[model samples]
Target: MWEKGYQTPIYLFNKLIGLQAVVEVVSNHTSNALELLAKQHSQMKTFVYQNQLALDYLLSECCIEIDDYKKTIRRLAAKIKKVAHVPLSKGCR
Candidate 1:
């Protein structure tokens, strides 16, 4: 499913940093995906700047279409929980 390997995790950490102007969530999301994003946070910041308008538009459009918000949150939370515990034996340490 992940085509880029680890070079670009969630591809949104830097965007998030740009979105909220905060570095706090970096600590919250240290899993594989988030870890990848965190590694290039400096560049992510720049990427966000270059695409803020489009990013904002995309996020806004996405949020507007979620009819079952609670279910979506639960599903996302479950997925995040699962990903957080990925066993080291699956690949690299």
Candidate 2:
């Protein structure tokens, strides 16, 4: 690669640090499709009530976090939305 004499591992795609970053980016974007979809609060699934119920039961009953998961999901949803190109079907604040 002429004129591209030497590039650091971080600069190269799919290489060590770059690979980790790539994986993280992908993971963040695609963390739990069901959960992410629920976060969208789409009308198709009644705001994804099934997924919400399950998450509510799990987090509240299993982990004992009341309304915490909602905040967490909201945060994660925000992040996922920022990174992933998902079409939001509802208004998210």
Q: Could you tell me which 10 consecutive residues in candidate 1 have the lowest summed lDDT? A: 61-70
The C-alpha local distance difference test score for the whole of candidate 2 amounts to 0.55
Q: Pick the candidate with the highest TM-score.
A: 2
- Residue range 7-86, candidate 1, lDDT tens digits: 35546554644544333333236343444544456455556665765776777632222122444444554566564443
Clashing pairs in 1: none
- The C-alpha stretches of model 2 lying farther than 4 A from their native spots are 1-14, 32-34, 40-43, 47-93
Deviation in angstroms for 53 in model 2?
Answer: 18
Candidate 1: lDDT of 35?
Answer: 43
Q: lDDT tens digits, residues 1-93, model 2?
A: 534634644345325445555666675656666465655544435445666778888788433322325456666766765665443336521
TM-score, one value per model: 0.23, 0.29
Candidate 1, RMSD to the unseen true structure: 19.4
